[model samples]
Target: MPEAHGTDEVSDARPGPIRVVIADDHALYRQGMAIVVELDGAAVVVGQAGNGGEVVDLCARLHPDVVLMDVRMPVVGGIEATSRLHAADPRIRILMLTMSDDESDLFEAIKAGASGYLLKDLPGEEVADAIRRVHDGQAIIPPGMAATLLQEFSRLSQAGSVPEGPEPTTLTDREVEVLRHVARGMVNREVADALGIAENTVKNHVRSILEKLHLHSRVEAAVYAHQQRLVPPDA
Candidate 1:
């Protein structure tokens, strides 16, 4: 049986333990994830589902803060489940936790409104950390996965004809500089010092970049930039 924590009623609560629903076809993996979330005192696995249909139903009933979803399932896959959940409530954040790091899976999940895409191979601690980050409205993508995502984006852009119209808003000069450093895999502090700016200022710019692009995280922004050929593929 799943453990239950006290449900406190506080409006200003410190974003109470991130409530999560784990959805995976494998029962063992589902239980493993549940254990990980519970181990982290700040996260709670409120429910579990084995298929896409169950995922959608649980989302409406439980309203979990995060969904640790799998890429493929029996009735419905993670991509379709994520879409259904997001359509029902755009505020719900979905995180794809899968074993496959396929570029197509990553792209489809992102387009379906996934706030984070992480591999199941990640340590339980890392998984917990990612859950918190996504709960805080940040997107998470593992290192190297960004490269695959960018490569796929480039292929799509090259194949399709560009539409003649106003382009999506571009990042500001300063924002571009920050993103350039980010694409190089520099952390926030490194970016701040390198750019001779405060860390908080760098963070603000990052937030702005995400908003402008309708992206969820720095990783996504970096990949998007690469897709647009904003930064050299080799660089």
Candidate 2:
């Protein structure tokens, strides 16, 4: 087992690396994560915290570009830590790394300001990719989890729980086209190339769509599109 580093800060102020912190209670998992993150050569593990309280403290101190937070922890837990961190600085992007697929956990994490949720069993490379994507302001949900998200949305809608504010304006024709591709799980680059537009343009459209629809992430947007039948199942 790799030696567990104490709660001191680890800084990587290098120009290119995406600064990150891993917050998992398990020591072995923390060591494994450090290796996985460093393998990318573009991300540096700035700190490691063993519980949610440490997670909040490390995040407040390190101010990493991304935080790989484990959902189940003794002190505060990932959901509460994420909420506190976001409340402190809304710009802090949190990508939940967990083992469970419980729908309640997924929904709560999202509600707590987690930008992305991914299972722990994902490949190391995929986890690295998710970190990059989330740092770039994209929401990440593991494949096959979209259906779960949709079911949650349906439940909320049935409970007469409208979104926090009034319903946002509808999408434009071109935005709808972009959303259709998004609903099919196409990333921004894929959607842009498919539409013959720049990737940045696709990003803009997605941001606008999220704002207009008052949705949280691409997963939510895709689920909403499906719930409203904007993009049919066979489309």
TM-score of 1: 0.81
Q: lDDT tens string, model 2, 39-129?
A: 9797999999998899888888888888899988888898999999878877677888867655368877877878867778777887787
Once fitted onto the true fold, the runs of candidate 1 whose alpha carbons sit more than 4 angstroms away are: 1-14, 102-104, 161-171, 183-185, 223-229
- Show the colliding residue pairs in model 2: none
Please report how far candidate 2 places residue 148 from its true position, in Å.
0.4
TM-score to true structure, per model = 0.81, 0.78
Best by TM-score: 1
